[model samples]
Target chain A: EPEVTQTPSHQVTQMGQEVILRCVPISNHLYFYWYRQILGQKVEFLVSFYNNEISEKSEIFDDQFSVERPDGSNFTLKIRSTKLEDSAMYFCASRPDSNQPQHFGDGTRLSIL
Target chain B: AQTVTQSQPEMSVQEAETVTLSCTYDTSENNYYLFWYKQPPSRQMILVIRQEAYKQQNATENRFSVNFQKAAKSFSLKISDSQLGDTAMYFCAFMRLMNYGGSQGNLIFGKGTKLSVKP
Candidate 1:
């Protein structure tokens, strides 16, 4: 019942500015992941992290995107220069082990103006 | 690469009725996992049910059950005695099993089917 929580449920930023989406995964979870869902589109994987390093990333996770576990509990995704196309609902997920299913946060709706 | 497909874009069922959402995937790996996630108006992804490829028996959780055909690469979710709360967008996802030292599991999701339970 421990859920992943995300802050700033709604974020609006200028096109060229930087933005950071924060997530607090389940306390005991080991793997963390980021996913994007454009309006009316399928959810797409952005990146996955484990053991304090990135395990894999999709093409959408380019030079402008980076993720870090700044502390033990917080996982943050920073976009250096936001583009209009970057506007989407970003979801953070975590799981306790290999065979366990990933639990998702409520999601942060990022809107670029 | 693995891909999950949900052919039905939208569906509706009367309250207390039953409905099934279809899903199919294209994958070469023998060992993997399939799942159904429900995203209500809140846009929160909630796990509905999971089916392991190695398991021959289908997974059932109360009113929610899965009809998994491993050979056909088909996995579908059946909701019995549906209610208004069941009105949500259902997504079918696929994930390859993780190796001890390999990459972490990442879900490949379908476009999703919006189910509306009308009272």
Candidate 2:
């Protein structure tokens, strides 16, 4: 089965630096999403992207966060300036069509120091 | 806004036994989807099963099955013949059926239940 793939499984960055988490969703998938989970917390939704645009975002997805589908298969989440709280496991997911179950990637563990 | 709740924080089952993880959600929308996802040690979120709100019958996959109560707004997952491989964090999620254009549908997820199957 085709699965969502993410690059840089583990990322470490300075607190004020910018970082980009990349994901290659299923080739035929049209919708993409980003979620994060603190070490011992629930997975929280960040943003959803479709048609190369953001559909909806949570409070955690503030100005510092942006998503882009620069290419047909690449969906990326960029954090302009990271904070200590930004350190978490970031996951990328996609669904083939509306009302379809979503498939999730292994996730990128972001560590900020 | 929709909220998913998994009351159990942790559970354990002996190998070959059965386990059930509870989940409840609050959603006024009539059309929606509920799901159970497993996150192993690798932290890869894997979809275990799904149930459509409109379907009165529950969904089952292999040893995994769901007990969906639409009227009570509850969706629980039952794992039969639990194995060591089944030890993982299980999450219950809800997604509204709204069309956000092409493929992007937003999902609301519960806090999750940590299940440990010991031999």
Error in Å for residue B119 of model 2:
0.5
Off by over 4 Å in 2: B99-104
Residues A1-113 of candidate 2: C-alpha lDDT, one tens digit per residue? 89999999999999999999999999998889999999988999999987778988999899999999886879999998899999999999998788688899999999999
User: What would the per-residue lDDT of candidate 2 be over residues B13-104, giving only the tens digit for each residue?
Assistant: 99999999999999888888888999999899999999988799999999999999898998999999999999999999988876543234
DockQ of candidate 1 against the true complex? 0.72
* CAPRI tier of model 1: medium
**Candidate chain B TM-scores, in order:** 0.96, 0.95
The local distance difference test score of each candidate is 0.96, 0.91
**Residue B91 Cα positional deviation in candidate 1, in Å, after optimal superposition:** 0.1
Worst 10 residues of 2 chain B by lDDT: B98-107
lDDT of 1 by residue, B1-119 (tens): 89899999999999999999999999998888999999999999999999989899999999999999999999999999999999999999999985562337899999999999999
| Number of the top lDDT candidate | 1
